[model samples]
Target: MKNEIRVIGGRFRSRKLRFPDAPGLRPTPDRVRETLFNWLRNDIEGARCLDLYAGSGALGFEAASRGASKVVQVEQDAAVCRALERNRALLNAEAVEIVQVEVRRFLAGEGQPFDLVFLDPPFRQGLVVPCCGALEENGWLSSSAKIYLEAEREFRLDGLPLNWRPLRGGKAGEVGYHLCERTFFR
Candidate 1:
C-alpha cells in the first residue's frame, strides 16, 4: 500500500497521521492531493472549506495546513470522527471543525456557503452528485466556489449540473478526480 504525506507547503509539513487502514477507508493519495492543492493554491488561502466523508480528515487538515481560514469536516462514522478530531488536535488545527453527521443531513442544515469543497465519499455509496446538487440548491456554495472530487475510476453521473466548467480531471491510480469551478452559480 502507498503512504500518505503531509502538506507540501504548510505548518505541518511532516507530521504523521494514523489514518484508517485502507480497503475500508480510501484516503486520497499524496500525489493526487499534491496536484489538487497545487491547482487550488491560490484559492485555498483563507478560504472556508467543506469536507464531506471526512475520513481521517486528510483533505480538511491539508486545507487548514495550507492556510484555509476555516474548514468544516462532516463524517458519518463515529470512529472516523474521533480519529479526525484527534488528528486535528495533533495538528493544532483550531480552524478545522469536526461534525459527526451524515453528509446529506449536514448539507440540509448548512447555513453558510464555502469557498472550497472536497467530496471524497466512498466509492459505491454514490453521494457526490447529490451532494453537489444539495449545495447548489441550498446556496451552500459561494458564486465562485470550487469543488474537488475523487471517485472510483469508472464512476460517472448521469446529469451533472452545468453551473461549473470542468477545469481538469484525470485518473489517479484507480480513482477518477475532478476539479471544477463555478462561473455563474446562480
Candidate 2:
C-alpha cells in the first residue's frame, strides 16, 4: 500500500512523507508525534537525535525539521532506506543521516552520544528492552537525554534502563508512547 505520513510542526510542518508498504512498518501517528514533539520542544533545538528502527522516517525528519542539529535514522530494509534518502533529499535535510543497517549491528558499533532518541521498533518482537540496553551500554545516549519509545499499548516499562525515568507517557489505541529521561547519579 502507498501511504504517507505528515510532519505536524516546525520548518516542515504539513510536509507529507511517503513510505513503502512494508510489514510492521507503522509510522507514529500524527497526533502522537505532535505530543512527542511538544514534550521535546524545550530540548530539541540543536540537539543530536537517533531514530532507531526508523520505519518511515517520521520521527527523525520531524526532529530535523524542528531544529535538531543532527538526526540519524537506522532501518534495515533497503527500500525503506531508499525512501528515507529521498525524503532527506526532498527536504534538503543536511542534518539527517540514514543508516541502512539492523538496529543490533548499528548499536554494536561506535557512535557519538545523542541528546534525544526515538525507539519505535516493530511491535511484539521483544526489541524494546534490548535496544534500550544497547543505547545505554554502547554510549549512544548523553546524560539526562530524552528518549521517546513507542510500542504495543500493553508493553511494560520495567524492562527499560535503570537510570531511565519516565517523564510523560500514555496510550493511543493499540500504541503506547513514552518520554523518558536518562538520569545520572553522582
Winning candidate number (TM-score)? 2
| Model 1 vs. true fold: TM | 0.93
Give the TM-score (vs. native) of candidate 2.
Answer: 0.97
Clashes of each: 0, 0
lDDT of 2 at 17: 84
State the displacement of the C-alpha of residue 114, model 1, in Å, after optimal TM-score superposition.
Answer: 0.2
Worst 10 residues of 1 by lDDT: 1-10
**Local accuracy of candidate 2 as per-residue lDDT tens digits, 120-140:** 999999999999998898889
Error of 2 at 69 (Å): 0.2
Task: lDDT for model 1, please.
Answer: 0.83
lDDT per residue for candidate 1 within 32-130, as digits (tens), equals 888898899899889999998888677888899999999999898887787888888888889999998888998897459899999998897778888
**Alpha carbon lDDT at 75, candidate 2:** 98
Residue ranges of candidate 1 with Cα displaced over 4 Å: 1-5, 21-24
The local lDDT score (0 to 100) that residue 169 gets in candidate 1 is 84
lDDT of each: 0.83, 0.92
